[model samples]
Structure formats: C-alpha cells, structure tokens
Target: MKAPFFLFSIVLLSILSSCGSNKELQERAPAQFNEVYYSQTENGLNLYIPVAVIQENRVKLESVYFRGMHSALNLDAEKPNLYVASFATGKGDKIMHEDPKEEYGNKAPQAPKESPFKIESDEAILVFKQNEKTKYYKLTGIEERN
Candidate 1:
C-alpha cells in the first residue's frame, strides 16, 4: 500500500525534475547565420560560419562544440561576419595503451583523456555569451566543401 505509493511518488518527482531543467531547449537562439560549412585542409579541418546577424553586440561567441569536442571560435578579420575554427588532424586518440613487457605483461588500458581537437561532423553546437549569460545553440545542415 504505502510502499507502492512512495515508489510512484519518487518516479514522478524524478520525471518532473528532469523536465524542469531543460529550459534552454524551449527558448530560441537570437542569432542568424548565412551558412555553416566545413572544409578539409592538409593541416586539418576548417569550420566556417558566416554570420548574417547577431541579436545584440554583447553576444560573444566562445567556441564550437562538435561531435564530442570543443574548439575555440574567432572572428575573421579579413572577412566580415565570418567566424572560423580550425582543428588539426593526425593527432592520436585520447586512449593510452601500455607497452607489454616481454610479450604478455600488458595490463588493461588506462582511462581515456579528453582530446583538445574537435571532431569534424555535420552537426555543431555554438556556445556563446550574451548579457553575461552563457548559452548553447545547435547548428545543423552543415555542408562539406572540397
């Protein structure tokens, strides 16, 4: 009787708590971009986001979160309203593999360390600061260029 009622109350509370925390998803981002694309270079990957407009001047772009990594973003001085992020390739993964002594002395691999390089993919997350508040915006439909 009471046990089942308490279990149901706990489940209901958890669902409500999770739903209340995602307020940002319900709000719209106040910026616009002309296009978002990525190009592969010999050095690495270059992401180009041409800004059509930002809702306010106080909005400062911090970094671009893609795949599972975050890369710094900066405005291009040569091009107007263009924000770019460059990620170097050829870097090895974050996993660390220990060398085996004699042939069979290898233990389990160590936990992975987060990589500094960004992941090249179609979807990106734009992290920015507006009015001293940090927020995130999802950017999809990113085109790949040669």
Candidate 2:
C-alpha cells in the first residue's frame, strides 16, 4: 500500500515542478511584445509602444492631432494632406503609401490603394492622405498578447 502511494506522490510533485512559472516564460520571451493598445480618429491619434528594455512594465504612449485633423474629425472644416509612421516593442507595424509627392526621403515605397499598409506586428507605419477635398479617414489599431 505504501509503495503505490509514495510513487503517486512523487509523480505529482515532479509534474508540478516541471510546470513553468510566469517569470520563466517572461524571461524566455524577452523580445516578445505586442502593439498592446491603439486608438485614432480624424481628430487625434494614440499609440502605445512598449520598450523592450523595460520589458513588461513600461511603454511609450503618444497621441498627435494634425493641425487640421480637428475640423475633419468634426466634419466642420477643411483638411490637408498628411501621413504617419511608427515602431514599437510588439510584433511590428507598417504603413505603405502611394502618392505623387515623394516621402520618407525616397526610400518610401509606393503602396496600392487596393491594399493599404499592412500592420501585422508591434511596429506600425501609416500615411494620411489629406487635401482640400480630404473627407474621410481610415483608422487602424491592433492589440495583441501572448
């Protein structure tokens, strides 16, 4: 009777110890990060980029509103052409754009309107097409965790 009970207890203890802890997972996944959070509109834009250095505790958050974005956000005034880009600790994000005007010092690649910049990770880059006729905005945001 005692032998079987001893073996079962040993097995249970081993299984419990072998199970990984949260801290260990975090250490193993040092670079693992996500966009975490983002929100934007015609009025303003918000982004959160967690620093790999800070790992899980710190993040960089920023929000910017173009000079004329307010009017467009409110549908009460005129807007101008605009563009934006960003990078973070998460997977990554990219915003490719196409235009008659060259941007990003010529290295910027022109993208097809059918498929706008694809943001698939922690880093992201976006371009705003604003003009006297600018009327609508395509807002994008991604939140991820693992």
Q: Evaluate model 2: give its TM-score.
A: 0.19
Model number with the top lDDT: 1
lDDT score for residue 136 of model 1: 72
lDDT of 2 at 111: 26
lDDT of predicted model 2: 0.32
Best by TM-score: 1
TM-scores of the candidates in the order shown: 0.61, 0.19
lDDT string for model 2 (16-74, tens) is 88863311111122223334354443333434333234222332212222212211111
lDDT of 1 by residue, 30-133 (tens): 47888799887655678898988886678888887665555799889999789998766534233344643444532333223333333346777777788887
Pairs in steric clash, model 1? none
Candidate 2: residue 58 lDDT (0-100): 32
